[model samples]
Target: MHVESALRTQPRAAEGERVETAERVDAVERAGLARSVEHTMAATSTVLQDFLDGRVRAAAARSDVAARLWADLADGVGGKLMRPRLAVAAYLGIRGGHGDDDSAAIAPVAAAIEVLHTAMLVHDDLLDHDEVRRGRPNVAGATRARLVGRGLKERTLADQVQAAGLLAGDLAIASAFALVASAPADPAALLRVVRLLAEGIETTVVGELLDVTGALSSPRDVDALAVAELKTAAYSGSMPLVVGAVLAGADDAQVARLGAVGSALGVAFQLADDDLGVFGDPAVTGKSVLSDLREGKRTELLRRAYAMADDAGCALLDAHVGRADLDEEGAAAVRRVLVASGALDAVRELTRATGLRARELAVDGVPEPLGGYLVGVVDDLVGRGH
Candidate 1:
């Protein structure tokens, strides 16, 4: 989507009053978003638990497997609830208020989008071989723990755990579709939601494939950006807004504008995340600070570092990046090179630019309160420390 020039023409508020007013507005919007997220989370929990209970009762003979799958899926819930919140925000943006009837109508679809996100995260953990998420055992990790407690042989346990994780991801995907199908929306709107969900899955899979290819073979800057747009932007960012707007009967133009805003927001979010992957504290991020360097993940940060580095810096990067045995000292050396080459500053600047673009798009045509909230979200996302 093209960026609207008119967005830049909007008048800015005066300095001190603007700051005070913006803070007050942000606080109010944050409180509203928090309440919406809480409602969505409660509804999502009810839907998932009810589904799990019915499935377990129906498959009594295989109750253990059913329960395990539900546990895995449940573990993926209750994080920031970003997707559902975005959906609710977009819905409110279009509908003008969060009345009881509007909330009742929106919660089911919001829950569906959250469920869809959980499904993708389950699969993503498997793909990334991440054993922990949110500082707890992920699906694969939990499965491995269960199998290990059973005294299974190492090889057999690994195989069984992988299978369990795969099946849990599959169940989550199927349940996502089921949730959307049962949402209380018009038949035509439901059709659009279904199409959006299908497209999200397809786009994410293609992006994942590109990510794998980048890691293994190419790892170009363009490829890295493409992966971010397809994998993170489309499903995690744009689709939620689109779904909510469609449910609120938004016409095609509004939907398109929201999609563009979401895309820019998503890209900025990922860029900030890339910065964290390299420079953030492990305690705050709930991850090893060196994991990205160890894996040589194809992020724009790394791509820029490579391009800007001199021969000695390039040699340092080549020697340590992606090395499985890389130690703390090696990672430190790589970080030094990145800083010396100005890659970190370059990426930070890009992230700020992207956030500005998203803010501009939100102000262009998206209604007030929602537009203001969207800008607040961009600020919060790009400013995240973890």
Candidate 2:
């Protein structure tokens, strides 16, 4: 979910060609595209902070949870503002990069997208039993550390952490919807955006069920690709773009086209993210190689590997893949199986294929700037190793 990379990634002529074919143009319309991204990002950040501040004021009496909630979420808000970037880019691209007013107008919806993303991560981390995200203490991890420091022990500590994370996510979700519903778009369009957000959440919940169950059931039974689509594509991928399109007054056909492209791109992005989780450099990706393996995540690689592995390989995976206390040694062993069974290669191919599909659809399915912009974004994301 590298938001900046997707929007900032330009097709060969993304900037200069639009303004001048032979030379890169620095003034007027070319600069507008860059300004759109900058304006939307800054506005989104301000909205997020204001939202947090309002919450703090409203709950100032018992500031404990609110304080920690603001601290944890606000601190992590800078980068990875992926969904908002997509939403704004899609909106501007659909509008042919002409409406700078739309940038300011779209701020609430974009901010809602960012807040919604944070809520998802908080819940996602909780569900995966992942105490860390982006190489830092997630809410659960931070809560646990605080409790331990305060002399709380065992079950009570865990229970308190759970409560904090769950409530924090709930609060964010409520606010996200509020923002979408209140965005300065046509009332009808605003309603559509809100519905899209709700639907995305519903879709995500279904995918999450499959994902956590993925750890318990046979890996072969889980449709790993479908799971990725459901979990990440709905809210994280297409919803933002669709929301933007709706706000921009795109027609049904165009909205549908963008949605499909978003879906393909979202799935591709998740696949890349999963790959990074397992194999990327933590220093570069801010993710760990061990967490996904330890979670026994039924990633496409794991599913494909299970199908492709021999008995010995299966036995090796069964031993170390899901253990809570799994260490570097166990992770290495799983990686060995992934590589040996060609699951790594297979997943990588699928990632590229998915990204390519999105680009193909975008080329003729949408307008020029959007089509070209998404093409470049997908290319960069697909090729990005970290």
Please identify model 2 stretches exceeding 4 Å from their true place.
Answer: 1-32, 61-64, 97-100
lDDT of 2 by residue, 274-376 (tens): 8998899887777778877777788888889999999999999999987889999888888899899999999999998999899999887876666766777
- Relative to the true structure, candidate 1 reaches a TM of 0.87
Worst 10 residues of 1 by lDDT: 5-14
Cα RMSD to native, each candidate?
A: 6.9, 8.4
| Candidate 1 lDDT, 1-386, residue by residue in tens | 23454444333435667889987986786567556645655665576567656655655567767776676667666677788889888887787654556666677677778777877888888887777888888888988877777878889988877787788778877777787787777889888888998999999999988887787663444467888899999988899999999988999999999999999999998889888887898777665777788888889998888899899998889899998888999999999998999999999999999999999999887866678888888999999884
lDDT, model 2, position 343: 90
RMSD versus native structure for model 1: 6.9
